[model samples]
Each structure stands twice: as structure tokens, then as C-alpha cells.
Target: MDLRFRDPQTRIGNLADEPILVVCPRCSRRATVTPERLTCAGCALVRVRSAPNYSVWNGPVDPFFREPLWLRADCCGGHTLWAFHERHLDLLERFIAAKLRERGLGDDPGLTLVARLPAWITAAKHRDEVLRTIAKLRATLS
Candidate 1:
């Protein structure tokens, strides 16, 4: 597919509708996390936040619970690849997959998720490796 991304200026919170993948603190297994709670089916563990005060996060952790994300893999020589959820992954995949990526900075550039992505992720030399890492992350979804 010849995809093109014009930087929709999508913020990290825009993808909050989907559950973030997180590692269960108890079982070290995969779990689903949201602003309110973290649920682990493998060990039947659940933790709810009293006050859901979270900011937009761009790393390998749930914004609310602050647990390590379940969907992360090593890539680009010492850099870690991560996504908040399926929707976030979809966005990253499209941006990286595109041969033509246009930077459309909105009023507040920091709020734009793609703009905040690490430099190595957008580097042409690392494109193939990044795609491979993305595929590996997707495989862990199930």
C-alpha cells in the first residue's frame, strides 16, 4: 500500500478510546489499562485509580497507571518501540509506512503525537527496522 500521511495533528489522548496494553504488576502478563483501571485476565488482577490524573504520554507505559506497556520491542540499536494501543499503533504504522510524510504542525506542536515522536523513528535509514518492530508489536496483540 502506498500510504501518505499529512500529519493530522492527532494528539495522544485522541486514541484513548482504545485500551492501552500494560504489563500486569502481579503476574507480569499482558493486561488492559485505561484512565480508571488496569485489568489482568491472566491473574484476575484489577486496580482502579482514585483520581484519574494523567497527561499525554509517548513512551512504553500507560498514562494513568504508569505501568510498563505490554506492546514494546527492542529496535534501532538501544531504542525501544512502543504504542499506547491498537489505534496508536495504527497511526504509527501509517506514518512510518508512508513514503511521503508531510509535517503539518498545528498551533501547539507539542500536542501533535506524530510531531513528538522520537527522531530515530522518522529517520529514513531506520524505516525498515521500525516497520519490523511495528509488526512484532502487532503480533503481541493476540
Candidate 2:
């Protein structure tokens, strides 16, 4: 069977709505995704692919439309974890932090969501979409 992957940039409908997070595991360097390229600060290595070299999505919908997809690539001395944000991690973190503060649960600084995160997030499968809906509802109510 022939397999093909879509160009990473092409799938993202709007750059404004989506921001990419790049993390290098080797040197523990992280940065926002750049439109032109991604250069690791710790090792000073750069991404050569014109389009983000992300792995193929196991689902039907394009990865850009799904929850943040973490793609790891060999970089520096080890690997770089690229988190393509459909909803942006910063916003999610803020939302969580705000809710935590409101409930007096204390802030979970540097909260990391790893495997099985999809199940815990609102609407499970559609995390970003559900989060957006919740935010909209909160705005409407407030």
C-alpha cells in the first residue's frame, strides 16, 4: 500500500489560530515555532524540511485540526519534540491555572500532559474544540 503525508503548513487553515511549540529533549530547549524554520538554541541545529516533518496521523482528520500533536525528531544530541497547537498550549495552561486559582486548588506550574491526556480533557477526543466551546460559554455567561 502506498502511503503519503500532507504538508504540515498546508493543513493549518490559519496561522493566527495555531501556534507551534518546539522542544528539544537532548538539551531541554523549547521555543515557539517559526514560520520560516526551527533552530534549536541549545545545540544550534536547524530544521531543514520546508514543511514541518510531522508523523502521519493515525486518524481521519488532519492533525492540524486535532488536539496538539507532539512530533519528536532527531536534533542536537537527541530529539526535538514539536507540539503543533490547534488551541495553543499557553492558553490551555492559563485556563487550567485560572480555574485552579478560582477553586483554590493551587496552581500546577509547568503542568505536563503526556499519554492518556486525551481522555481527561473535555470532550475527550476533541480537546481543543471542546475547550474553545467551554471558553465561549464562559465568555457568554460572564
Candidate 3:
């Protein structure tokens, strides 16, 4: 008879083992990570994924196999805000820099920059800028 409480490691289904490309915090370079470790090509820093929330599943293997699992990376200093298909991040940074310059917030890290996401997204100009930058970034990756 098949045991209901079999060893999790020994039991086999369609275990997810995909890597996510991200930017390393220390060196600020491209890297990829699996459930095992995060490997940075630029800085040559490797770290194990001890966090349980790193790998997230959507649904059952058959039903949700088409959807990709979101892999969160934290191999860097802390929770590095880098993930796959996130070229918009670069655009967001550029936009913030421009705004800072317009407001003459020059080189001051003391003043925090906060933006309303809904407003930013709703603005046609900002949305266009983000899309354009994302396209450019994707081209570079290609």
C-alpha cells in the first residue's frame, strides 16, 4: 500500500527548479539564481537560498504549469529589488533622477523620494516613458 505520509524529498511530482535572473546588489551586475544558490557573474559571489518564501507556486502542476513561478532573490545585502522581466526598474530610476533634478534635490540622500504608484501609472507621459525605457532595456538584453 502507498503510504499517505511519505517522505517529501523521496516523493516525486513536478518539482520546480527554475532560475531567475537578477541584478547583484554589491556589484550591480546581472546574475541568476536557483533554489540552491545565487551566482553572480560580475562579483563572483554565491549564496544559498535559505528563505522559504523564495520559491512560490501558483497552483497544481498540470493546471498551472504554463505560468512561471516567481523567484525572489535575496542573496545580496538584503532584499534586493531585482527580478526577471523588470526592465521598468531602470526607467523608474531615471524618472526619479529627473524629478530630483527638477526639484533641485541635488545629491541629498537625506530627503526621501516618495511617489504615488497610482498617479505615476495613470499619467500618460510617465507611462510612455516607462514603456519606452522597458523596450530599450529589452533590446539591450536581446
TM-score of each: 0.89, 0.31, 0.36
Cα displacement (angstroms), candidate 3, residue 100, comes to: 33
| Model 2: lowest-lDDT 10 consecutive positions | 1-10
lDDT of 3 by residue, 1-142 (tens): 1212211221111232334555564575766655566677889988765644533432211111122212232221332222243433343444433423232233542332222223443254554544454445455455
Give the clash count for each candidate. Answer: 0, 0, 0
Arranged by TM-score, best first? 1, 3, 2
> Candidate 2's C-alpha lDDT?
0.36
- For residues 7-79, write the lDDT of model 2, one tens digit per residue: 2222223433444544543454543344444455678766544655463443312232232223332222232
Q: How big is the positional error of residue 78 in model 2, measured in Å on the Cα after superposition?
A: 25
- Alpha carbon lDDT at 33, candidate 1: 89
Best by TM-score: 1
Instruction: Assess candidate 2 and give its TM-score to the true structure.
Output: 0.31
Could you give the C-alpha RMSD of every candidate to the true structure, in order shown?
A: 1.9, 16.6, 19.0
> Which digits, one per residue and each the tens of the lDDT, describe model 1 over residues 4-106?
7888889888777778888899999989987788999999998988866755476778888889988788999999988887778888999999989888867
Q: lDDT at 114 for candidate 2?
A: 26
How many collisions between residues are there in candidate 1? 0
